[model samples]
Target: MGYFVNVEPGVNLYVEDINPTGSKTILFVHGWPLSHKQFEYQFDVLPHMGYRCIGLDWRGFGQSDKPIDGYTYDRLADDILAIVDALQLDDFALVGHSTGGAIAIRYMSRYNGKGVTHLVLVDSAAPTGFTKDTADHFLHLALNDRPKMMREVTDSFFFQYATEEFCDWFFHMGLQAAGWSTAAVIELLRDENVQQDLRQIVTPTIIVHGIHDRVIPFSQAEEIHQQISNSQLLPFYYSGHGPFWEERERFNSLLMDFI
Candidate 1:
C-alpha cells in the first residue's frame, strides 16, 4: 500500500511501501516526469528478496499533489527526508534514478545521510552539469513546448526497441506529470549541479548507466564515478537509458549482488 507524506504546507508526497517489516529497507526515488511506478520491475522482484522497498513520487509527479511551484531540488530533497522521518526508516539504502540521483546527492550532502547506509545511482545526470547547448535546448522545449518535449524524449531517449505496450505505458506516465512540474523541474535540474554535494558523499556508492543512453549521456556516469571517491561504476553495454527495464535480469542480479 501507499501513503502520502506531507513535506510542506498543503503538499503531500506519494510513496508506495512494500515488505515494510523486512530487516533492511531500500528507498527508490524516480526520474523526471515519472513516479514510483518507474520501479515497478524492481518492486516485483525486491520484496521477495527479503528487502523492503519504498518508492516516492515527488511533488507534482505521479499521484502526489501537483502545485504550481516548489519543483526545485532543495524542496525535492526535503520531501525525501520528510518520508524518512515520517516512516522512521533507519539503516537503509537509497536508490535514485536520473533526476532523482541529483536529489539524492543533495539530500545526502545537506543532511550527511542521517539514516542512509548505501547509495545506488542509475543513469543519473552529471554533477558537472549539462552543457550550455543542451541546457538551452531543453529549457526552451520545457518552457515553450512541453508536449513536443515529452513525445520526442519519450520516444527517442526513453525506449529503444521496447514493445509497443511498454512504450505506450512509459509515454503515458510522462504525460501524467503536471506541465508546470515538467517545465520547472527541467530548469531546476539544469541550473543545480550537485558537484560539490557529490564530493560530500561518505557513504558507499555505486553508479550504473546504460552505455547507449541518449537522454543522459554515459559520460555523465563516468564523471560521477570519478568525482565520488571509491564509487563503483557498472555499465550496461547492451542497454540504453532504461536499463532496469531493458536488461532486467542482469540489472536485478547486479542490484542484488550490490546490496
Candidate 2:
C-alpha cells in the first residue's frame, strides 16, 4: 500500500502509505544506509490496528533524490518539517531509528509538539561522542582508501545476528543511493552533535534498545532514558541495532501496546 511520490524539486521522496485510510498518523523515519522501507514492519502491522503509519528515506539513502546538498542533519530535519507541512498532518506519533533518531530530536526542538503526539527512538543514536576521535574514525573509513573501509564500518553498524543477505543489501544500497558526497558524510559524522538534547524533550517518549546492540550500545539508550525525563526504555533481549528485524514480533507487541 506504499509508493514513491515526488516530495520536492529534483527530490522525489519514497513514501509508503502504511494506513492510507486510518485516522491516526504515524511518522516513521529510517536510520542511515536504509530507506523509508526500513519501517516495513511498523507500516504493515500498525496500519492493521487503525494507525496510519508512514516512513521516509532520508535523501541519498532511499528513493529520495541523492542531491549533492541537503545532507546535513539540520537540512534533513528541514526536509521532514516540509513533509509534515505538505501532508498537513496533525497529532501524529513520531518514530525514528539510528541517525533518524538524532534528526527526530532536532526536529522536535524546532517544531515542538506541533503535531507529534509521541516520540520513539529505536536503537537510536544520541548522547554520544562528538569529538575529534569520532570524526577521524568515520572519516578514515567512509572517505579514505576509496570508501572500501565503509565495509568494515557497515559491518559493525549492525549486530552479528544480521544475515549476509541483509548486510550485502544494506551496504550496496548506500553506495547506489547516488551523490552522497564524502564531505556531506564527513560533516554529518563530524558535527553530528544534537542541536537539542533529549533531556529537554518532554513529550511521551519510548526508547527501545537491543541488549546486544554494539552499534550504539544499550548504555547509550540507558543514558538517554535517564536524561529524557518521563521517558521509558524497553530492552530487547534477542536483538541488536535493528531489533524490529531481529525481534519483529516482540517489537510489534511493545509498540502496539504503547500506541
Tens digits of per-residue lDDT, candidate 1, 128-220, equal: 445677767866887787777777767765445877787778888887888888878877866778888878888999998999988788888
- Candidate 1 clash pair list: none
Off by over 4 Å in 1: 143-145, 158-160
Candidates in order have lDDT scores of 0.84, 0.74
Candidate 2 residue runs with Cα over 4 Å from true position = 1-10, 129-131, 144-150, 179-183
The lDDT, on a scale of 0 to 1, for candidate 2 is 0.74
The alpha-carbon root-mean-square deviation between model 1 and the true structure, to one decimal in Å, is 1.6
